[model samples]
Target: MDETTYKFLMGASAFVIAILGLMLAGTTILPEVGLEKLRKARSILIPSYFVLALLSLVCCLTGYDRRIEPASTLLVASFQALLFTMSMLVFIRPNEVRWKTVFRQAGVITVAGLVLFVSFFRFTDYYSCFFYSGVVAYVLQLIIYTRKFMLAYRKTVQEVEDYYDDDEENRLVWVKCGFFSALAVGIMALSILFFPVLYKYFVPLYVVFYSFMVMWFVNYYRRMKFAIPVIAAMPQEADVCAIPETVLAKTDGVAAEEAVAVAEEAVAVKEEKSGAEHLLKERLQKYIDEKEYCRKDVPSGIVADSFGMSKAFFRQYMKDSYGMDFRPWRKELRLREASRLFAGHPEYTIEEVSEMVGYNNSSNFNRDFKRMMGMTPKCFCKQFQ
Candidate 1:
């Protein structure tokens, strides 16, 4: 490419990068979601945009110098690495990530990338080989992470499913789309290795795509109240089914009378808790028999409140007793009601059955029915006829 054309391309990229950086800066500071982990992850984009802007500046300064090309490749690789790291922070459980460890790893990566950039350009005669090797490494890492991300994505979807009955809205399936889109765009960006001339055109498009993704992610998660309760070390209430080991241990040195009293008190507490659990179980079964779960969009908090329990405790009780989360357990009740309706009222249409069973979306109802019953609703109904 001519010097005039190269300068114009670099100038345009610099202007675009500056605009993109400003937009990212505004969002990072005033993100729509108040989640601390998400906010921290978005903050990483601030430096990413700056890295991009700096890369554009460097390209302009070096103006097609083949030796400096390796440096530019390394910069792009580093940016991609940061992006993948940010996504890992976004998808994983907030408490699972250690930001200090992440920062330390990032520091190591930056230093290694710098060393490679300088060593290959200044000392080695194998600049071309180094550039190709870097590209190969980046692609290999991307492929490996993409597979890992698939597993994480499925687990996240299952977590969401465990909370919300309406799988159509709550399953974080859109995140998978966003992930693969970014992967495609990253691959396109790396194509600069083979087609350097197209970089001038591609960079602007890449910037715009990334900007759209940022807005979509922020807006969607802002309205979503996604939560997965962490398990506690001990039950919150003093009334528990089992006595703490500490209680029994502390009785070793006590007088025989005191020890007997402690043992008797513990037994009383245990019996009280056991009776309460049995009563709760009976009340819940009666609630199910009445088909209270057939109500549309009943909040779990309200359901728990009716039973004089907190939502977290109610959910834990359901999991422990039924071997399933609240939503899944509710789903089973709904589907069972639907099956009964199909058998007893064969005149009912699929949509009617779905609505009666608390499913607003017939498509989702059919999907879930077929998955559980191993046949579609229409086919299931025909069995009775």
Candidate 2:
């Protein structure tokens, strides 16, 4: 590469970095999602970019001296290290991921990377091997998130045509950016190792990619208008690392909104489920009272059908509403009614009373009543007498 070309690239990158630093410092770069973490991230971003710009200028100043290349490499490595550290702060999930954990992990990565660079470049004269050592930890972190994103993407697409959900979809935004940024880093690192000449231009190029991805995440997340629920469960994947191109951007908002309404029947899932459960309880109670359904030899199907609900859902409703299974609860109600009949209508024979309550045989009724109520029917009646 010619000196003129190198100077031009470095000068351009420095100017761009300076502009981005000013934007970060002024907090004018973000869209206003009303999230405090991102605001705090912008606060940290100001100085990090300024330092990165300074480092780039220093590297450009010492470009002619091959003897000082190791120092330049170390400086660039330090900048990369700080880049990921700031990234960790920016994307740290308040509840799902801890800030201290990210800080400690970034610290360890920086230390380990510096140690490897020193050992390789100074001791063994292998300057190239020190490359990408700074990024290993953050890349691994992104790889983990990438896997999560792919799994989520696959699951979401299974039910729908695209990946735009209003509920918790915004949560995956940063992870998607992480996946792309990590891919760029991996490619750049590999290219520099295999083709040392690639480093001359690839540094500026990869920096451009990295900076755009970071800035996009910040602005995009801030504009992501939705409530963040608990991070949805990511489906398990074996060893898949396939990255599809730029998924979250091309989603059809009209189609997605329509699909969500159709998927959930034009109601918020929580609100719909809540309202349905409440109605189910009310209707079931009304059915039971009007028909004395519990006193009948009622099949679960009959009881559920009377309330116009599926048997399975009715059982779930019973458990959720009353904290017991449907059949046992019906039996308890029947036994109580039988006790009331025994006490009030003493002249009615046990067989007659049992038959009225839908019992086919008095002996079976007495036995079940004894088992549940701890007394025989006649004994129960005697006490009432």
- Please tell me which predicted candidate would have the highest lDDT against the true structure: 1
- Global local distance difference test of model 1: 0.67
Write candidate 1's Cα lDDT for 254-347 as tens digits. Answer: 7998888878888887786577578679879888889998987565666877877656667667888998877778888899999999999999
Worst 10 residues of 1 by lDDT: 227-236
Worst 10 residues of 2 by lDDT: 159-168
TM-score, each model? 0.67, 0.46
- The clash number for model 1 is 0
Give per-residue lDDT, candidate 1, residue 93.
51
Model 1 misplacement above 4 A: 1-17, 28-34, 57-67, 124-133, 136-155, 161-170, 197-205, 228-274, 289-328, 336-364, 372-385
Question: What is candidate 2's CA lDDT for residue 188?
Answer: 63
lDDT of each: 0.67, 0.56
lDDT of 2 by residue, 1-385 (tens): 4566666666667678887777556545443343455556566557767876776676566553444443445445444544543454344332333457656755775676667657665766554445445345445654665564466554443322111111123344454565556556645654454455665667676567547745655464443332221112243344221111222333455577666555554345456557767778788678657646434334565566666666666667778778987766766666777887888998878888777765645676787789988989888888766
- What TM value does model 2 have? 0.46
